[model samples]
Target: MEAKENTTPTPTTTTTNQPELFTASDVARFCQVDLKTIHNWADKGEIRHFRTPGRHLRFRRLDVLDFLRKYGYPIPEVLRLGKPKVVAVDDDPVVLASLRKALSKRFELTTFQDPFDALVAVGSIQPDAMIFDVRMPGLDGVKCLERLRSIDTTSHIRCIVYSDAEEMKKNATEAGAYDFIKKGEAAELRDSLERLMGLERE
Candidate 1:
């Protein structure tokens, strides 16, 4: 499997109001990958900030952190290097853990009992696809999908909706979800995922 994005987000103090004040060394450590990787980050526009009159490139502290998370750089509650490479979001802890257990051996899966955290992590994990419950505490599946689409990096990834509420199926499909598997339809769910993963292969 691919290692944790191979990043190096070095830490540093930023100029109070300046969003761009990172040094080469700061980025090196913030990303936790390597200095060369930092340069590659800048080159890729994954992270960028300012330039001095002498043309010295600088990075923002927040940007560095965002990039670190986006790349799944071994942060809290995240297991980057593993199988399945799947991310599943549901507010119910029992359900979340159960799904993780069922799928962990089959895929590199990560579970988030909170949809909000999953929303934030999506940008980082860049999971090939996602499965989220419809009725979350703060964000419903459709709303969460909206948020996901708003971010350029995670927009194109396939998402599946799993909700007991049949009402969400239309909304999820309209929102461009790959499919909305009514809760308990494990076979249908598996089929949807197989179809999606097949598309990835193509």
Candidate 2:
């Protein structure tokens, strides 16, 4: 009998490639500005940028596009869709889902069910604003807000705290929360967020 060869299928993996990143020179050229100006924008957080492990600045293509839109610069055809970034943290799946449904249209929304992950993101992404749940498993919202305010990099971010417990509102406000929304008040929260971001709800 001939020896049979064993044939096994190997699993194939896929990777989601990130969008092309824009260097400072690329951004300066696209914005019709000097390279020094691009550096200044990144330094002051006027534009979003990522720091490489080697400490070099890298700009996101979409973020640069958004900056152009905000400054009335003509957006390129590939970069026309620009919206403000907002970070929302909640332990409840329903609340997160509601937030996505409500705010995704007007803003580039990032949601985190884990408060710890949200805290880390705030420091790195430096979102325009944040919405947090007052009660969560670890690092409750009030404490989280306080920590953020204490950090110079994240201190200026507007923070809103929401909870089912009415008494926590005072705690949230004192902790540097920009506004407090009672839990389950999705419409009110949406309106408040719009007002905070200077966006008119449609």
Candidate 3:
């Protein structure tokens, strides 16, 4: 009866976690480009990168995904971090449409035509960033920004005030906005967002 005892063993499974930061050679391999090209990109500020204490270059996973998406490169499965969640609140439907067209590909965008509604949903949305219009009918962007800053739950969300009135920049900054981008400056907005993602530029 003792010889009839079974000797089955349980199989163990292992999982590998992807890195949050990558080396130049790692990025090169991911992009299918030579190491020199990666260096060039870093030098030219075409990709988001930082230098280690030893002067070695390092890139964040999100930044690599941004580079791949911006340049039409195929994103490797290992490097596919989800897009940054963004909430754009603007009273103007047209402006919201333009934002959708411009940033939809790079960000997981949610738009609100009413500032109060945006505020109500912000806690639940937990967006990485918010795009606010300086002037709106119900709650102006600056006030919205102030409200969010006062709330502990939404205070840490990066807020960007998108407006054509250059005069509002000061107020926006005072209201705790991370940056103010003049409307129609798509490139500047993209650059600001890249910086928000912790990209270091020389």
For candidate 3, what's the RMSD?
A: 15.3
TM-score of each: 0.55, 0.59, 0.58
Instruction: Please give the TM-score that candidate 1 achieves against the real structure.
Output: 0.55
Evaluation by lDDT, superior candidate among 1 and 2: 2
Off by over 4 Å in 1: 1-84, 199-202
Candidate 1 lDDT tens digits, 11-70: 112112322236766767655668777777677877745566796777544344455667
Off by over 4 Å in 3: 1-80, 199-202
* Local accuracy of candidate 2 as per-residue lDDT tens digits, 78-102: 4333455677877787778887787
Q: For each candidate, what is the lDDT?
A: 0.60, 0.70, 0.72
Candidate number with greatest lDDT = 3
Sort by lDDT, top down from the best: 3, 2, 1
Model 1 global lDDT (CA atoms, 0 to 1): 0.60
In each prediction, how many residue pairs overlap at the backbone (N, C-alpha, C within less than 3 A)? 17, 0, 0
TM accuracy, model 3: 0.58
